[model samples]
Every structure is written in C-alpha cells, then in structure tokens.
Target chain A: MGLHFTNGYVRKKRLQIILLQMQHIIALTVLFHHSYQSKGEHLRMTNHSAPTLNELVSGVVDRLKSAGPLYYLLLLITLSLVIASAVIGLLAMFRGHEHYYNVTREIPWGILISTYVFFVVTSTGLCLVSSIGHVFGVQDFMPIAKRSVFLSIATILSGFFVIAFEIKIPWRMAIYNVISPNLTSNIWWMGTLYGVYLAFMFAEYLFLLMNKHNPAVICGFSGSVAGILAHSNLGAVFGLLMGRPYWQGPYMPIYFIASAMMTGCAVIIMFHILGYKINGEKMDGDMERALEVTTKVGIMLICVILFFTTWKLIAGAAGQPNGAYPVVMSEVAGHHAFSFWFWEILLGMVGPLVLFILSKGRNLKIMLIASISMIIGIFVMRFNLVYLGQSLPVYYDLGVNEFKEMLTYSPSIYEIIIAAGGFGMTAFFFLLGEKVFDGHKVEHH
Target chain B: MNKMDFNKLQNEGVENVPMQQRRDFLKMGLAITGIFAGGTLLSAASTFNKAQAADFAKKYPYSPHYSMVMRQDRCIDCERCMEACVATNHVPNVHGAYRTTILEKDTSDAIGSTKEFIPVLCNQCNLPQCTRVCPTKATYKDKTTGIVMMDIKKCIGCLTCQEGCPYNARYFNEEKKAVDKCNFCIDTRLARGEKDTACAHACPAGVRVFGDLSRQDSEVFKTVHQIEKAVWVLRPEAGTRPNVFYTKG
Candidate 1:
C-alpha cells in the first residue's frame, strides 16, 4: 500500500512541476509582450502621420482594384495553384502520407523539407540584406529595403504554409510546443524563435507602412536578430546529430548563416529588378545605385560560397574519412557529380559571378539572368544539402543487407505539386503586395 | 583453427549453427566491433578497464536501471523474438518498422562462423538523443523506469527524433501518426508485473538477456561488469551511453 501511494504521489508531483514550468513560460511571454508594447507607445506618439485605418484599407482596395488584365491573369493562375496544392496537401494529411510522399523509414525527409529550408533561407536572407540600409542606416542600401522587407514576410509565410502539410500533426505542435517545451531541442528553439521573428517582421512592415522610422528600425533589428538565431538553430537540427557524419560539427550553422547572406544578395537583386518591371517604372538614380551595390555584394558572396564549397570538399576528401568520404565522393565525382558541377558549382557560383562582373553592376538584363540562374542553382543546393546527409546508411559498415547500400529518395508528384504551391504562394503574395503598396515606394526623409 | 583456411569454410547459413559450439571468440570478439563501420565504434578492449566492476557497484541513476545484454555469437536469426515483439507490441509488418530486429553480418574471413547475427532494439540510453531532440517532450525518458517512453498525443510528427537516433531504432507509425520504438516492454510486460521483455522471453538461443542493472546480482550487471571478454555498444561516439550491450560468451 505504501509503495503504490508513493508511486502515485511522485507521478502526480512531477506532472504538477511540468505544468508549473509551462505556466512560467506563458507568463514570461505575456510580460515580454507588455514590455514591447510600452516601448512602442513612445514611438507611436510620433507617428500620427500615417493614414487612418479606414483610409489605409480603402487605399489598398483601390490599388488592388486598379490592376490591369495581365496582373489579374497572373494572379488567377497563382491562386489556382495555391488552391489545388492545398487540397492535395489536405488529402495527404487525411489519406496518409505513405500514399502521397516518397519519404520512407530510411529517408523520412524529402523534398518538402528541402523546400521549407529554401523558403526560410530566402526569408532570413532578405531580412539580413535589407537591414543593412534601413536598420543600420546605410544610405546606398535604403532604396531596396521596403520591397525586400515585404518579400521576406511573403517568403516566410510560404515556408510555414509548406511545412504545415509536411508536419503530419501540426495542430498538436501548436498546443504541445508551448505546454511541453523541450529546452534542449534545437527544433523547439528554431520553431519558437522563427515565430518571434515573424511577429517582428510583421511589426516592422506595419511601422514602415505608417512612416514611423524609429519603430520600423527597432522592429527590423529585432527581426534580423531573431532570424539569425532561428536559422542557425535550424542548422543545428542537422549538425548536432552525431550519428550523421556528413552534417555533424559547427560547420553547418556557420555555413547556414554565411550562405544565407549570399542568398539574400541574389534574391534582393532578382526581386528589385522584377518589381520595377511589374510597375512599369524606370530605375531612378538611387534605385540604380542600390541595385549596383546589391549586385556587387552578390558577386562577392558567390566567391565566398565557392571558397566554402572547395574547403568542404577538400576536408571531406583529405583522409577518405570513413562515413564522409563516400558521401563527398558521391557529390564530387559520383552519381551526384553532374548536379555538383553544372547546378552547384557552375550555375550557382561561377556563372553568376561571371555574369555580375560582365554587367559591371549596371546592366539590368545581365544581372537579371545571373540572379535567375543563381536562384535555380541554390534551390538544387538546398536539396543536395538535405538529401546527401541521409544518403549513407547509418549502419553501412555492419555489412547488413538492409543498411549496406545508400538510401535514395525522389519527390513524388504530390510532393512536387506541394512544393510548387510554396512558390505559387510567394508569387501571388508578391504580385498583390507590389500593386497594393505601389511598388513599396521609399521617400527620402 | 589457424591451420584451417578461413575463406574455404562453407556458408552453412543459420540451419547448422551448433548449439553447443564454443570458441575462444576473443580474437574475433572485435569482429562485431565492425558495427562501428562508421570509424567511431571504439572497442571496449581499448576503453573498458578492470575498474569496471567498481564502476558497476556504484549506484546507477535509475533505481531499477533496466538494461539488455546481447550475446552476439548465440543468435542464429530464428526471428522468434521479432515475432514475439510484434505480437506483444503491435509492431506493424512494414519493411522498416519493427520493435526489435536481427541484423546479419557476413563473415567470409572469420573462423568457426561464416556469418553472425546481431539483435538490436532501443538502447534506452542514459543520454538518449531521441528524448533530447524531441521538440514537444512527446518522446522522453521515463523518470521512474529509465525507459524511453512516448506520449503519442504530444507528438508533432516531425521525425526529428528519427534523424537524431544513431541506432535506427525509431519508425514513424502511420496508424498512430507518431514515432514508435521499443520501450523495453515497459507498458506491455513490466507494468503488468513481468520481469522480462517479450524479446528476451522469446529468444530461444539466449541471445537477449533483460535485467535490472541496479541490482548487482542481476544477469545484466554480471555480464556487463566482467572484464574477461570485450563488450561494446553501437555508435559509442554518439555519446548516448546506451543501456544495451553486445558481447561474446
């Protein structure tokens, strides 16, 4: 009787303690919200200059209604893709992922994971790149800030949308993530920090819309910090797995941040040029200079990435390290050699770098081609990063039939559709944002 | 045996495993160490010391300190333990999902045996990576039993824990919509007052021995504490400090 009572009591007490910990976390979040609002109160006092709520809503409606037939056609196409993909994703959720996704017991992550990484990387990159002008007050970088900020929000939202379906029980995540937070889990940190980052980005965009310089800068800085932390935590999710030799070490997190900066430059150049085309506006002097600087930054970053790739390959090949050697060889000169050479090395780094140089940071046509190439190349790069780590079976050396050969996974048709939906979501939102915000115009203060 | 050509030994497969056969097995003791095939599977010969008995005498973190010791040479891949595990644990019959399974290693270059069967299950580690990386505390080390148990309702279906595990013990359970793995029969038998796991009970060749390591007299403690033969865990560099051990008798 005594033993039974003690067991019951101990279990009850432990559950109470966990519940108490959760309460403290929720309370801290509330306290943080209050403190943030109080800080904003001072800044809000100076920004009575923004449009009233009704005026803002009407203005957005007016701008959206004023779009041409071609804009509507493009919007319709993107919207249909979104709707179709959502239905497919929901079906996968209800019907079971086995029927839809290519992920298996050996390879539980597939294209959706890589696509999610791509979107978030693009989002974090945009936030970091644009913060140079608006948050840090760099003059040449200012013109691209508003549009880049808007795209960052769109891209992150797309990322969340895509991952929602991939996560089989996403609703449980919302409830349990708060009540049962694992402090040691990198995924937990990444999800929580990215949520906070999203909130900051939203606030920054709102402040920018209201013409509140100080609040916008404050939010922008906070968003950038959160983005960096969240993105690195995402890297640690892979890097900290000691079992997976290819992704293990400090290299992944550092590489993620550095590669994020490079991706940011490429994205900033691509969208800025596209934004002007959509609005039928000629590039003004300040805008032209901004693009030129962004291009130069892109060129430098491509070189940086090339250096990183070279060293990573060299390190992997140096001793023909047991687990990593086979994987490195596969990427360098095996089955994946073509992707490595054409997509990753040539198109991702060299082709873009050469094109950027030839453009001399002024030729929009050449810069556009380079940026487009880089985008496709980087997409493949993200795929390779996620896929190659899982290629070598965890027990390859045991000489067991089950784990002897490297695992393989290709995105199913359903997965390809869902991945396309992410791109469609970004495109639709971007087009709407371009029109509604009048090309995200910046006025010199 | 040294005079015998090791390569000329015919692969009799599992049908002719001599139940009474015994060899020094010390030289080939390091054969299973190839499980580290990843280069990090450090042998206990180099790491396990005579001081191990004293270390085993100390109080373990878990009161019962549940553990399993695999007699690597004894398994003949009959798979009765697997059938018992499935029957008891409701393990799905899919290709990759199993509560406990046998891994066969071909030893064309070894003496006495042309093949070896290694049985594997969740280590219920002292430092379980699955529990550490689980975002929602969905899969956690049970405070009382030291078994890595799952709170299925709390699972987000992230599969991050699957990636984190070094032993490939986890699989995404479609019916449950959560990751499932061996819990050492904590719920099925231990809670029902059975002292042993289904796999241990069903292993006909004495390949698996489940016991409480906290008790010095337990078979697990006696087997693991001995310094005469080499004992090791899979992926030791993962630093998970697994409760499961593999050794040759």
Candidate 2:
C-alpha cells in the first residue's frame, strides 16, 4: 500500500511540471508573434511613400472614428473662438487699435501680450527639453523628442497668431523686421531670431520625419541655439526696461529660462500621456522610462523656479523699490494675492512638485492631475508677471491723481477672444499632429 | 577738540579739520561727484546717435541744441499752453493724449496754501531709452536740433517707446497709428524755422524759457549751468539727464 501511494505522488509531480513548461512555451510564442507582426508592419511602412495622401486620409478617418462627442465639442468650441478672434482682429486692423483693445499709454501691454509670452515660452521650453535628447544625445529623453519638437512649432505659431492681433500693424512688422533690423533692440532680435528658430525647427522636424539622422541633429542643434537666443531676448524685452523698476534687472532672463524648462517638462508629460490615451495604446517600458526621467527634470526645474520666485518676492518686498513695491505688495497682500497664493505658489510650484515626488514617476493618473494643474497655474503665472509689472503706475511715487495708486487693466471681450484663439490654434494643430504623425511614434533605435 | 583750520588740518593728516572746512569739503565733494555724473547725464542719449563724437559736451550737439527750462512757480492751470500746442501742432482732443500737459501738485502743507501746476513736455534725455528701444527708428533724436523727433510713417505701434520713457511722455496716436510725444514742436513749428516751441511761445506767464544750450549766451545754458538757485529736474534719480530743467521763481 505504501509503494502504490509513492508512485501516485510522483505521477502528480510530473503532471504539474509539464503544465508549467507549457505555460512558458505559450508566452514565448506570443512574444515571437508580436515581434513578427511589428516587423511586418515596419516593412510595409518602409516600402510605401512616407505617409502618402491616401495614408493621411485613412489615418485621419481612423482618428475620426475613434473620436467621441467630446472631441467634436472641443473642435466646435475651438473653431468658434478662432472665428470670433478673426472678426474682432480684422475690425481692429481695418479701423484702429483703440477701438478694440483697452490698452492705454499707462498700461500698453494687456492680456494678448501675456498670452503670446505664455505660448512662446512653452514652445521654447519644449525645444530645449527635446534638444537635451536629440542634440545632446541623452538616451532617456529621446522618446519625447519628435512630439516635443512638433508641439513646439504648434505653440510658437499660436504665439505668433495672438501677437498678430496685438500688433497694430503686423504687415508693417513683416516688412520692417526683414528690411530694417535694429540690432540693439531686444524686440527686433527676438523677432528675427524666433523666425530663424522656426526655420531650423521646421527643417529638424522634416528630417525627423524622413529619418535623416545627421541632418536632423544639425537642425536640432541650430534650432536650440536660435531658441535660446530668441527666448533670452524675449526676457530682455522686459528686463532691459530702464524705466520700469519692477522689470528692470537680469533676473527676468534667468527666471524665464528656468520657468521654460519647468513648463516644458509639464507639457511633455501631460501631452505624451494624453497622446497615448487618444491612440488607445499602453505606455511601453521605454516610454515609461522617458516620462520618469522627465518627471525628475521637472522636479529639479521646479526647485530652480521656486528659488527664483522666493528671491523675487523678498527683493521686491525689501526696502520697497519705488515702482516695484506697490505691484509686489498687491501680489502679496492685495488684489493679486489670490492668484499669487492659489495659482502660482500652490498649483504652479508646490502642488506639482509634491505630486510628482509622490507619483514616483509611475502613477500616470496622479502625474496627469499634477500636469493639468501646472498648465493652468503657469498660464496664470504669465498673466500675473505681465500684468503685475505694468499694474503699478510708472510714476507711482508722484502721488498725482493720474497715478495715485495702481493702474487697472481688464481684458475686453475682443482681447479675451483673440487670446482664446491662440489656444484654439494650438489645439487644432495638436489634434492634426496626432492624426498626421501617427502619434509621433519613435522608430526602433 | 576739532577746530583746526585747513593748513593745520593738513599738517594733522586732515583728521582734525574744522567743521567750517568740512562744509567746504562737502561742497567740493558734491562738485567733484557732479563733474563725473554730469558727463554721463549729458552724454547718455548721444551714445545712441550714430553721428556724434564720444566727448559730448554738457550742451547738446545739435545746431539749435533746443532746450527748455520751466519756472515751476509761475505755472497756472489755465492750460492755454496746451490749447496753443494743440492748435499749432494739430494735437487731437482726447483724454490722456497730449504732446504736453499740466500736472497739478497739491502742496498746501509744504507750501503755504495752494496747489501748483507743473507744465511738462519731453525732456529729450541725452540717453533716450525710447530711441534705443525702438525696433524701427520711428522715434529718433534729431541730429541737427537735439530734439527727439518721430517718423510716424515708420512706426509699427509696438509701444516700446512708451514703456521705455521714464516720464509718461508717449501716447499712441489713434489717428496716425503711431506713438506721439512732445518733440518740442519739431515737426510742426521747429521745422518751420520757429525760434521757440508752440508751448514756449504761447505761455501767457513767460514760464517756459526755450533756447539753444550750445550757445553760452542762451538763458537755458545759464540757468542749468549755474547752481545758485537750486534748479532741479523731475525724477533725477532716473538719470535721464533731461533737457528740461525746473526752477522755482
């Protein structure tokens, strides 16, 4: 009876081992099948004309079929806003700027300027962030390069769109910017260099599409150099203001670059994740690594910006410099207090920083929440920076009736519509990018 | 313990200088400091000028070298000067859009009883931030007259000049689609071989003294150069080195 029981136990053990081995073989077969299918798809792509018109149409149709009511609603809203902006901008263009914009001699720049700054800054940040991978050959950052570069172009174009309405004679600018360049003027340099940056970026993206590695690298490096110059010059527009004590310093340029990096990281993470969801694809291991690295970089830049903001507040508060003090005080304890505390300090900086750390760069949902909050916060940050600097009267110390306290500037409907159009342009282009670029899929390296 | 004279103080290593000598020293120190700063104040705007020597004199390098000195105490709120400026220069009638304006200071406590009117126009700073910042040389300092002038045709209406000006001197001209400021009536009157600006000529109270600083005999030169009556400029800390000087009657 004991010998019979031992033989039965041995037979059962052999059966369990056979089942385990079968499970391993099945897993290997599935892996091989996935690779073979992917290889087949790649060959198909390589043989065809790169994204031919037929492919584009089919790809777009596929996206349209996947798109829900929410997508249509977003598109409708975007189109309506853009149309409204166009009507108002044309009216102002034909008539006079005074008819549409509420900008006065006291406060020349309004919401449109802020919106333009926000978009371009984001674009510049994306370019820089992507350059870290493409130009400098950082492995972890490589996965995001194509999407980042594409988005950068979209955002900067949006910036140009908003600013076109703001500028009284944009046509004149196009002519004069080329024919009559002012080297000393930061605005001129910024405008010209931004043009150059756009050219390089366009070439880089085309090279990326064609898979021309060396040319893409060259264009990317040149684009980075141009972007840095243009971005710093943009900062210098405010910094070099000798009269505006609030904006008069080297701090603006430095803060702008750091803030750009922070913005770039937030935007890349947010959009890349969204891109994945829209495409109905899971984040693979490499993409996950890329996001983790981005989160790390975001953490570092957030600290840099935090340090910058702290110093800005302390310095602006200290001894109360004439033009700077009133605006600073308002931001701290007056009208801007709510925006400063809730948006800039909490959502823009602290919340994102903490959330990112907690996420361990793995929790997508948490990171998404942080990214969305940050995007909103950063928008307000730009508005605050532009408005606050100009909010206080240029002659605040004069104690005159015209400039007894701070100046007020609320965006008119026209201004708001035009600014919103910038967002519409960005969204439209982004959707188009997703469809046309096939989710900006990085080729296997 | 410290009543030593200059000679005695010099022998005593200047540590024991008398209080009277210290007062003289203060004056001397101020004069020396002024000499160094005066060059910068006077030469700041000339640096932007393509046609100019490095050694720009305290007096401007223009032919007429137009300058204005305001007798601050004599101004009244009659605004006849503004009216005349508008009539002569075709300044549009609008709110906060003036080539020149009057700023009233209620100094009832500081002075004995009443408010004072400050008639202000472009100082045409030696280092004109407006000109330097203008992407298109729409606003420029005149090489011939040292007057800050504008080419309205070239303006893109960026408003950078308005931002750059220390004084609230520039305003966007709606009709012209360009920034307009006090060019000392250069386009309207000064170009027509007028001796003084429209405002200067039209002042009922002789409050404005307009003249060429390059000529030593001019009233503006005398008033600005001599420090006897404590002549000053508004927001001197801005370091604009304004061509406009303000003095109390």
Candidate 3:
C-alpha cells in the first residue's frame, strides 16, 4: 500500500534523505570520538589507551622481568622434559618402531596416537573457539583470539611431535602422501587438510601479531573452515572402519567436532589463567569477562558431549552387535571401567560442569581446578575412545581360540616417555609463547 | 551326477548317513568341507545352492579373477597349508607375521562332539578394505590377477590398513618392514608358472580349491555353482564380497 502511493521522484528524494542521515550519523560519531580523545580523564576512565612507542617498549620489558624462583624452576623442568622426549623419540626412530614400541600387529595404535588426538583436538577446538571472537566479531570472546591462536599452534606442534614417533617413517610419509595422493583415503585428507589448516593458522597468527585486524579475521575464517574439515576427517578415520562397529558411524565425526570445541574452551581457560599466574599478573576486567563467557560456553559443550557419550553407551550396549557390545561393556563394567567411570564420566564431564556452575564463571580458583581436572580427564577420554574401539577383537564373531575375549594393550616405557615428552613440548612452547609474544597482550577490535 | 542319483540322494535322509561312513569319508581325504554356511550344511556334490546361487563373477573387475573356495568341514588342523605358505612366501616365523593360519571353533552344539578346525587367509575381497586404507599404496589389488599384493618399499608401517581389515588378515612383516597379507603366492609361485597356490597343493583333505572365477569351467567356479551345496563366505555381512567361498563337500 505504501509503495503504490509513492512516485519515483518521491522514492529518490527519500533515498537521498537516508544517505544524508547516514553521513550525519558517521560525522557525529567521529566528532564524539574526537571530543572524547581530547579529554585525558575520559580516556583514562575508558581504558582505551593507544600507548606511545616508548611506553609500549617499556611495558614489554616490564612483562619480561623475572617473576619468581618457582616460575624459573617450572620452565627449566618443562624444557628438560621436552629435550628428553625429543632424544628418546630420535633413539626409538633409529632403533626401529616395532622393537621399542608396544604396538603390535593386533593393537597397532597406542598411547601416542591417543595423545596426538588429544593435542590436535584441542588445537582444532581452539581455532573454532577463537574464530567466534576474531572472525565472527563476538565481543566477549575477543580477548582470547590472540592467546588461543598462539596456543593452537603450540598444541598442534606438540601433536606432530608425538605422531612423529607413531608414524615409523614420517619422511617417507611426507614423500608418498604428496607424490601418491590417495584421494579416497580418510588419512590422506586428514593429513593434507591439516597441513593447509596449519598454514592458514600460521598466517592468521602472523596477521594477529602485525595487528592487521581484517587480514587476521579472513585468515581465521579460512583456518576455521580448514580445521573443521581436517578435524572431521580425523574422526572419519575412526568412523569409517567397517570392522569396528563401535566407532563405525556418524557419531565419531560429529562427536569429534563437538568434543574439540569443549576441549578448546577447557584449554583456553586453563592456560590463560595459568599464564596470568606464571607472569604474576592478574586477569584484567575484560579478560575476566571473556573467561566467564567462555566458562559458560564450556558448560554448554560439556553437556553436549555428555549427551553424546550417553547415547554412545546406550546404543553400543543394547544388542551386543558384533564389534560394539564388548567395547561398551569394557568401558562400563570391564577392565577400563575405572578409567571410564572415574576419569571420563566423573572428572571430564560432571566435575567440570559442576565446578563451572559453582564458580558462576568468576571464581578463579574453582575454574582453575576444574580446567586442570578436565584436561587430565579429557586425555583419558581420548585414550578410551581410541583404545576401546580397538580392544574388541576383529574376529569376535569367528569365535577363535586366541581371540575368545577382548585384547589388551598397556603403554610401554618408551610410549610413556614419548607421551610425557609431548606434554613437555606443549609446556615449553607455552611458557616461551607467553614471554616471547609479550604475554599475548593486545586490544580487541 | 544325473537327476536319478540326485533324487535318490535327497530321499535318503541326511541324518541316516552312517557315522562310520562319515568318519571314513573324512579319513579318505574326501572331506571337501562339511559345507556349513550361515548354520546350514550340504553334501559334497551339490556345493552350490542351485536355486539361489548365481554368477557373481559378473562383479569381478580383474581378468584372471583369482578366487578360493574353502571346504570348511575338511580342515582338520593339519597345518600343512600354513607350513607351505611360510615356506613359499618366506614369511617371517613370528607370532603375528603369518600369511595364513588355522582357527579352531567349537561346533559341539551342531556336530555333537568333534571340534571344528577352520582355515583362514586373506579373502582378497572384491573391495579390499586394506587396499583402500593404505595411505602410501603399499598394499593394493593387482590390476590383472585381482590378488591383493603389497609393495613393501612403499609401506610406512602406520598399521592403518591392518586396522581397516575386518578379517584381521594383514599383519606387519618385521623382516620386510611392511604390512603383508596373502597374495596367493603370485610373485613367488604363480608368476613362475605354478597353476595353484602352495596351500591348495599341500592340502591333504582337499580343504582348499583355488582357481579363476572368470572361467565358468574352472574348478573354483564349478565348486561354487554346483547348486546342491549351500556355498557361502565367512563374514558375508562385511560387504567386502570376497573372492573366497567356503562349503562342505
């Protein structure tokens, strides 16, 4: 009815008026900002300081000053652990994988694979979580984008370190995976996409470092897409196995992405708070608010994954389908029951959910305790996911003599050392990141 | 071989067969297989269920279409086939390095008292999960023979293929530093002009019958198509559509 009454001249005049109004609004905003800038008291009250170069340099120097004896001792220990893990990994590589590792023909994967999954899942989660702030322009998530991006790179690097030992000839893999590309292979896609994802992540991090907001946002978007693709492919690696019915469904790929986000939130809060403690600095107001929102997000995802786990258990145990039944039982009441119940269910899901609630997204101590517990619990969760799916014999229906029951695998000494070394790599790089990257401090867009 | 004999054989209840005769049949090395499949049994001459069995060779993508039919009831745990495979393939004599092995199953419910010995090897599936999961193309199906072969040099020993296989057929060969499974002795024997696999030749109970499925007249094809036997495969639900068939003669 409104359109029918208006003439072309009238519409044109109205459009011209809107354009003038938009310009007036922009001019008024600029004038307001300029007036605010002139008031030093107002600027100080708002805490939006564009520090001079001298002030910036002094601030960085101040941040680099020694914190305490305990901090130095922690750094020294983590670095030593990293060095020891690298040396052991190299020695095992030279000696041959089959000789040193407990991985056999039956149980071909071990703790190393699970630990790699744990680290990389956290990386993908961090990328996805940070993209909410940096790419999607969510104000509450802004403070974490820089720190999470740096930690994502560190965590993925740690993942690669552990996988280097698991993959017997990584150099050969580097050559063949490119020259002889298997388009249909899930592993090929996971590896290749992760490589692209890493490149994008590095570019995204570099852009963030240079304070190029637009370019950093674009890179973060690209990195998120790549991370989702790569992370889902990693899940497909387990899901696509026709023999492993426990993991042979959409549940794995879907569960992985959800779990990654959960892990991302956990690691982000844990490390950021820990980083603050290590530097003897407290979380400022904005950063504290960001963690509060992130904690709420963590609670939501914890519930999502808890739902996934419940369904996984229910479906796996119902019929005792060839490969799924025994695995579910093992996790529920069998040998892995303690780890599953105590670590995966109680500590990983319930404890964090409860603590996040009690903290109300503000209590640093409770949040810190919850985050640390969730990290350990989530590591065990990854281990169970990888191991339980394989613990059931492939030929369970065949009813063979040797495979009358479930198979068992315990991490060997070398595997344990390599896994510890992987953790050390994360710690070492994380400590260095805090110092070298100037505590990852910067203003959000 | 004729319709009259077939009719008479059907009229005689399967349970009427003398225990001594059955024992003698196994002893005389004619125990082709009890031909148990999906919990049903059939006699020797009628290896295939005529009404149900069809020419599945239409699905074969290779020229030679190499296949094996296991006469399951005939396997008596002699392990001669296992020895022959190791000797022929130069397979490492280790716990998990076998190219083939025998399995013992308790069939006490069905067979009254005797435990059944089953022979298992690489099915060389029409859609081999092992070949599909190998990131480096270290393990692959042959273009001409349909035999699942391996290029040990390309194997990175990730063991992903071993995990992908539903049958637990493939294993890491520590000697070769690669994943290895039954290739039907293609390189060691078949390429050198041998007509059959080492296990087929050494089977004292005629437990293994290996031949080309592409040739309708081949022993493997006839044994699979004779229509009287309920011929089937192990783990048919896996959807691998293996070239191997198992039946009791």
Best by DockQ: 1
The order by descending DockQ is 1, 3, 2
Docking class of 3: medium
Candidate 3 C-alpha error for residue A83, in Å: 2.4
- On residues A1-445, what C-alpha lDDT tens digit does candidate 1 reach at each position? 5335457779788789888686555333222110111211211222335434434344445556666788899999999888888999999998888889999877888899999999999999999989999999989999998889989999999999999999989999999999999999999999999999999999898777666789999999999999999999999999998888888889888889888888899888998898888877799999999999989888888888888888889888999877788899999989789988999888888999999999999999999999999989998999999999998888886678778777888999999999999999999988987766667777656
**Model 2 Cα lDDT, one tens digit per residue, B112-183:** 335777888888888888888888788888888778888887788788888888888998888888888888
User: Each candidate's interface RMSD, rounded to one decimal?
Assistant: 0.9, 1.3, 1.3
What is the DockQ score of candidate 2, to 2 decimals?
0.43
| Candidate 2 vs candidate 3, lDDT winner | 3
Candidate 1: where are CA atoms >4 Å away?
A1-62, B1-42, B45-59
Compared with the true structure, what per-residue lDDT tens digits does model 3 show for residues A1-445? 6555368899888789888686555333222111122212223212354444333333334444545567667778988887887888888777766667887777888999999999999999999998999899898899998889988998998999999988877787888888887777888889888899999998898787667789999999999999999999999999988878988988888999999999999999999998888766788999999999999999999999999999999998887777788888889999999999999988998999999999999999999999999999999999999888889887777787778888889998989889988898899888876754656776543
Task: List all candidate RMSDs to the true structure.
Answer: 11.7, 16.5, 14.1
Q: Candidate 1 - CAPRI tier? A: medium
After superposition, which runs of candidate 3 have C-alpha atoms over 4 Å from their true positions? A1-65, B1-57, B109-113
How does candidate 3 fare on TM-score?
A: 0.85
User: lDDT per residue, candidate 3, B1-249, as tens digits?
Assistant: 898888767466659899998877765453334434433532322433432236344565687999998988889889999999999999887777888888888856553446877788999998888888878787888989989888887887778898888888988776676778899999888999999999999999999999998787898878876656667777766778788887765
Instruction: Estimate every model's Cα lDDT from 0 to 1.
Output: 0.85, 0.81, 0.82
The full ranking of all candidates by lDDT, starting with the best, is 1, 3, 2
lDDT at B31, model 1: 50
